[model samples]
Target: MRPINEIIVHCTATPEGRPVSVAEIDAWHRARGWSGIGYHRVIDITGARLAGRPLSAVGAHCAGHNTGTIGVVYVGGLAADGRTPKDTRTPAQRRALAAELMELRDRFNIRKISGHNEYAAKACPSFDASAEYDHLFEGRERLFKPIVDHLLQRGDAGQFAQSWRDQLITWRENRNQPSPLLSSQDPDDLFGHAVEAETLAFQRERQIVADGVVGPQTRNEMRLALNGRPPFSALENYQR
Candidate 1:
């Protein structure tokens, strides 16, 4: 056990939905003068998980933070059409992905799950895990609704979770960045309201009275979530 701490999700930037070989990934990394594939596993459309990097080492998938994370890539089905419907992670692949994640979750004591796009700001997965990944496990949406809502508000929470959010916040603070916070009054637009809604939902779901406010309780959940210990409330009514 090399003390794995994080699991970062990604999509092959390629157009095809086929399984990729280890050699191909290796060569891709080598060509960039990197050590190896930036992911620990690559899940093809058929649900096969191919190991990319060794467990002992960190990957290079996410730009800012890869030293403590495990990267997993999936074959992408996203088309150039710009609509997300055409891109889907096959059920078999999703199932395999879930199983693989569970194994890693147990092995490494990981608690949080995230997509690549969230970390550095690239939509490699092309689909929203918050929006698309819940169906694989029934009633999962309710489990992740708060987290998902918060992430959705940022338009990149599916990928970043909290680690990158903290990083982004740090970046903003360092640069004296003003909040690009969107308007939250309109329920329909609810633009940039994911974090707020999610925090509130999480608190309320935890029987803490979800005020839709991001206070200490919500921040604590986010912290624990990044480490993979989602609140028990999230597991309720969730399909295994």
Candidate 2:
């Protein structure tokens, strides 16, 4: 597994799905006077996973985590018909991403799955990867499910996303195993720890120098990450 443990996601901010070569992507980054294409992979509109900067090279994707994690960019930001039309990823792209993630998981034995929202304050990827997020934090405790339903307000959102919530629970458990850090004793009254951790992860991923605190922008990322996944009709424990 090459000491692998985390999967970080990003968005191209455009749905063009234009297959830009790695060299070209690098050139663009150079023009900006920045490092290289910040991610480990890029999934185009057709769902083709364009392998990007090598993980060994230390990517520019997620803020601080870039030092020790792999990054993937899915074409287009994830909020569909979002604050702007630019924020949508094609269904084909989504399928490609699922495949890529599965492959990466198998090949690298990656443990944590988190969106840009989880790492830092910015909504770089624009899509939700909450199931993985939940999994990363909760691990294998039976209490994971109950925790997700409470944190995400499960009954209000659709079934597909809720399913991911469960997947997050399972995915989290598979990689890290149980730890007291995810103790059921924590207060679930409001955002509190959930919001705090998400904010901190975002701050670190985005490389934004700031203490972790939930604000308007952070809240937006939370909504996007939690709401982006499909709410399949067959999902169980879905309230509405």
**Model 1: runs farther than 4 Å from truth?**
80-86, 130-240
Best by the TM-score measure: 1
How do the residues 148-198 of candidate 1 rate in per-residue lDDT, one tens digit apiece?
212233343443344434433443344465335422232222224554644
Which residue ranges in model 2 land beyond 4 Å of their true spot?
15-24, 78-87, 132-240
Cα lDDT, model 2, residue 97: 78
Over 1-240, each residue of candidate 2 has an lDDT whose tens digit, in order, gives 224566777776643545445555555654543334667787866677776665554455654565446788777673444345344667787788777777776676565677887767877676577564444334523332110111232123455434433433333344454322333344233433443454465445433323554332233333444555321111122122
In angstroms, the error of model 1 at 29 is 1.4
What's the TM-score of every candidate structure? 0.51, 0.49
Worst lDDT window (10 residues) for model 2? 231-240
